[model samples]
Target: MHINPYGEDPVRFAVELAVDPPSSAADLVARCRAAGVTDVTGREVDLDDVRRFLDEWLGVVDAPDEAARADRLNALLAAASAYPRLTNHAGDGWHLHYRDPDLPLAGVLRALISVGTALHLAGRGMHRLGRCAVAECRRPFADVSRTGRQRYCSPACANRDAVRRHRARVS
Candidate 1:
């Protein structure tokens, strides 16, 4: 079966990029490729735009409450973006692409990330994406868990958190 390309990877890409944004278009593409971003568009100038866009995205994440979340996300959608379209890159059958052609890297990312995030958070659960529970690990994680109680980022973090709690109780 053809797994959805816009699944875990794109959401993870957003977290990775948001956590530590790349400095160049090549860097963006390279990092994305490393993170499992298959199909892509844009180059150097596009990368610069992507960096700027990420800064704005971070602000949304930092927003205080649900009202602010909607405001920030809506602001992001209203600014220099577009609706979803159909594409069939490499004749791989049609799928919805939420971007225009040849957009600079930032524009492409804004759509990909926004749409990918929407799909991920909605499909998975609103609480899916979040910071790891381990104190020192500030990494973001997209919870692909079958159960919705995923508070920590990974098994390591979950174990570490449980251990910390146990140690504190014993002490």
Candidate 2:
């Protein structure tokens, strides 16, 4: 069965990109492919454009409250101008696309990330996306945990914080 592309994967990819953006168009294309986005069509990608888009996306992550976050995301969705359509572009099987045909890489990413983030937030919880609670590494993350209590970006950060707390308690 074809998994919905407009789901956790794209949100996770957005977090990954925001945390450590690609350095070049080739790197972006490769990373997209690695993230299972095979339809890398349309105009040649501009690295600067992609970076700028990602910065705008981070606004959604860093918004102060649910309303603010929704407002930021709505702006992105409006900018995407995406409409749902069925496509089997790679002959994989029929699936849904939320973008026009042959949009540039940046446009495609904008639609994918915006729509995916909306789906994730609405499906999971509005608080599902945020920066890591660890003070030193405030990286963006999409909380895919079953319990929905992910605070740190990775286990290492969580463990480090836990150990620090333990030492403070001992002291």
Candidate 3:
């Protein structure tokens, strides 16, 4: 009976999907399920809907300032969110859901991502999300590091950039 709040996991999932988008509807569902978004099952999900949501969600990821990010997230929240409710369906434990009870997969993802992003930025820091600092690898990332100073999408990118800087210094 673990509670899965729409926080870090959903934000990381959003970053993963944004950085390396799924190739198909099935792939999207599979990735969501793999991420423990179990409610995605038993719902109608269309590739186009997911793509549209991701396209709009990228607006939030790429926003240049906190205000812009808030604005973009507000749009998503407005479109997707509803009143919070509690349920214990299938003995999954009592938890809050920020969407309607019967939302489809795409709707669930939209609400999850919007609310999750808001919660993450609010609970963490507004600047906790961004693109990788490496010029050639501007993939999106959620900076959940201890210092919240993550600049690269992953350690590989960080190491690559570090080595590149060292070569530049020697040259």
Candidate 4:
């Protein structure tokens, strides 16, 4: 199956930022670059913009139901999306972009994350985005597993919960 390129990675990137926000503008830009973001010029407002966007995205993740999630995401999609365009920079294969050209780092992130998240939720299940089930660890997690049954943020959390249950049962 041809998985959508814009789906998984962008949601993962959003989760990473929401988990541990960048300490500085440089750190944010560096993280973006590490995530294969292109055309980042390191503008000062990028940090604030990205933080604001992440906050809004968290609202989507924390939505009470699928309809609410779709509402929040639709708002983001309306705010962030632009006309689609095709580009082939650096001789790479041409790809469609849903953002305008010459946008700043934050703008790029907003477009990518919003559109990618929409595609993910629409293609996958609407309940795919969620927080960890562990009581002490409410970290956000994107359900990327093939079966779409991810409840914890990581295997460690699942194991921890299992051990806790085992201990409770033994006692």
Q: Say which candidate scores most in TM-score.
A: 2
Q: In every candidate, how many clashes are there? A: 2, 0, 0, 0
**Cα lDDT tens digits for candidate 1, 65-160:** 646655776787677457767777647687776677676656667877776666676677666666676869857676778996777767888898
In candidate 3 the C-alpha lDDT for residue 29 amounts to 87
Tell me the tens digit of each residue's lDDT in model 4 across 39-118: 57644446888899999999999999999999999999999989888776535677888888777878888999999999
Per-candidate Cα lDDT values, in order, are 0.69, 0.90, 0.88, 0.88
Off-target runs (Cα >4 Å) in candidate 4 are 1-5, 42-45
Error of 4 at 88 (Å): 2.3
Better of 1 and 3 by lDDT: 3
With a 3 Å backbone cut-off (N, CA, C), the pairs that clash in candidate 2 are none
Off by over 4 Å in 2: 41-43
Error of 1 at 46 (Å): 4.0
> In candidate 4, residue 137 scores what lDDT?
99
**What pairs collide in candidate 3?**
none
TM-score of 4: 0.93
